[model samples]
Target: MRKSSIYSVLFGTVIFTTITAALVSVSSNVAIAQILPISDRNKSENSISQVNVLFVNPSIGNDTKANGSESAPLKTITQALRVAKANTEIRLAKGTYSAEMGEEFPLIIKQGVSIQGDPGSQGKDIIIQGGGEYLSRYYGSKNIAIVGTGNAKLAGLTITNPTPRGYGLWIESDRPVVENNTFTGSTQDGVAVMGNAAPQIRNNNFYGNGANGITISGTSQAQIEQNTFQNTGFGINIAQNASPQIIANKISGNRTGIVVQASSSPVLRNNSIFSNKEDGLVVIAKAIPDLGNSSSPGGNQFSSNGRYDINAASATQQVSAYGNNLASNRIAGKVDLTATAAPVKPLSLLTRRTPTLLNSRLQRETVTPQPTVPNTDSQELNYVQIQPGTIEFTAPGAASQSSSLPALQPASTGNSALLPVPPDQIPASKTGSPYMLPPGLSQNPATIQPTPQTPPQITATTTQTGSRYRVIVEAVTPKQQELVKFIVSDAFQTNRAGKQVMQAGIFSDRNKAKNLVRQFKNNGLKAEVIME
Candidate 1:
């Protein structure tokens, strides 16, 4: 509850509105910016708690006869929304609430009425798919899942709207708290803040949407922080007079990260923009983004994007980029690099208990090392590059995001234990990815050289299916490619680090895959099976 000149909320944390003071932040740097320091970074409880609680379970509860209680909960979220009043809390159970499940589209959440799902899982198990037409005053009829009309909150829900020109959540007017949610597979943006709305959007996972992760327009000023936007078209799209504060979000793996156009001005600070196929931050038209200045350091990090990290599309527009970390030499447009931003160390390099000061949360700038293999002289090479150990960012309030390398523990047999990478690290095969690596990093396993056809021989799949698994056999030598012909589906997958690998088949029975594992083991090859 510490007070300061600047009001602030940490990434992925449960945010309750204080809305005391907010104004232009881009004109200055993060160092001089007055951001409220939260004495408790992980504190979820705050003043202005919900007045009433209503429960809805799509599995067992009855929609028509139920009283929206815990035991006798409503069946569908639409039913709960019909009876929920202002200041009421609607709790959803773990299940799909879609058209097939009887959920009505474009569920309108009234002011002060909060809708919450499982924040811990980022609502992965709590799916709310399908969208309905929402008539917006700014735009015409639009298809969206939920519309937050002023001071309502949508948290801990996995929302998707697959219709053409659809969005997961749309906010119009007033302020809303949209946190700890997963917005994916939408035909349009995961969330759109329009019509002078200033919503607090933090700790959400936005991916695989047709358009940008979050599109801000019509003078909307949103506090977008601590969100990880990957594999989307554009991470954050700002257009036409909208001015939002974009802070501390990791925007990567998209065609482009942040695009500001049509006279919109956004304050960008402490964000990690890296390894995108194109520019990280594209500023077009008359839009002016406060990247950084001499007086206040931006503290933003950029690296390894295929094109320029920050592309000021207009040659006439000299982006006032001062005191910000610039890792790449590729530059487009006129940018004022008057001052050098301090080099931020990776999170793995620091050791601390909890961050009380706002500056301590400064993100790591991406650094890409040369992609080369280990020579024969080197006895062992830990293929994983320098990745920060366990750093947590919130979409589920406490999820750590970093590329994990294979551990080279001293084994008696001198074989490295190949572990499966995090599911999110791997880019989905649905899109065209040049190489969605973590700052251009890939390491070779111990004693195992990579083949030309399949970069690394030691392969592991992250997906898990019940009662069956995919056996990963190491093809250390090129001649070993034909050792197993059990490749079932052309489920060709690229590893999280953008390394292409030959994946084994997913047998219907675990026993069949076990036989393959045993067969590979008998052939003096190290093999392991993981889920799916």
Candidate 2:
């Protein structure tokens, strides 16, 4: 058995282990993932998220006051993430998000939340930088920019980690979607998949990272399809029981194209592995990649390298390359180049995976001076919510109502009152009364008249700070709504004796939250808010 000690990479603790020391055992390498315990894999979260969308505009956001609306956008990704719920879409604008911008590093992407930018242009102007201390499961206290988990989606952004041996994206969740982004300037690897993450990585550009553009290890079953890997130490490195499906990727112009080691088993098909400064493909340390077999033909193409096109000379190995296009003289090891093998079945190509920028199940928005909320839900539950500001949605035609929920005031002693709304939902007004005004306004909705409903109370689980409030916003089935009885929050309180809710907006300066609640009560949608 391999001997190993505790090391950290911001997953758990902070004993910094160098790259050279990680090489002592393959399990200690930066590419090795902290294997999660059984309890972590089966963690349970039952509450459906109330937030449909969150907009982040670093140029003009309010980490303290903004409600994560397109008009009243949040100031930082960290704040948006803090309040984000499952299935929430965190939309980012074209700007640099760095430590200078108050963004914490290793932005842990929660389950069902999507962090997106301009995917059409391949995130040309979207740049996220800097590193923060993360407690690794094994490697303690490593710097990472982003950590993705819980079926999250990362798309249309440019991510970079410049710290020595830092990773750009560390994936440790199951079945997340990573697409249409650029990974550049990371010191170690651009994107590393560890644990049992079965991520779909596609349509991305991996350029100019210090080590491999992408690293797959720790039993991750990733689907790497249609990505461009260039200008790296090694374009793709597979190690330690990682059996990824490498299909239709362009791997070229690197120190070495692909390196498989330490018992990795990746299946390659239709890959253009060619033209590297060193060997095109190096298989060592008992790694036996499935190029192809006699029954099935591998459509992989290999070409010119400074050394041999395929190098497996040092280790004892016999790999099959049935019908894969390569020159026999350029190979240095025992490779089966039986090109004329009969096919058992037709080759199944890997298809590209794309996530709906805006799913119909979520809120839809249209472009204008302000965001236009959709009318997707039935009249009973038809409430306006935040929509994508920068990205357009293909969801059916939506209306122009923006949801501005007024929250309850928090009480001390970690306990407060609840203002519960009735079951199902209350139909919304066609006019979308009290639509949130554009940012920088002295008084939003310039036209909302005040009412006399007492503001709802928020119960506290912790001490409240920096203008935090929890407003009941949506209406769910009574069975689900019963959770409010047992659950109390600093920003959220449950006290409404099982009734319907109202939407609200500004009333005056003395009590904006209450005033907004009163005004929104006119629209019939209860709201909630929390301050961290």
* TM-score of candidate 1 relative to the true fold: 0.56
For each candidate, what TM-score against the reference?
Answer: 0.56, 0.55
RMSD of 2: 29.4
Error of 1 at 334 (Å): 1.1
Error in Å for residue 44 of model 1: 33
The regions of model 1 sitting more than 4 angstroms off are 1-51, 339-532
Candidate 1 residue pairs in backbone clash = 6-34, 29-296, 383-443, 463-531, 464-531
Best by lDDT: 1
Write down the lDDT that model 1 would get.
0.57
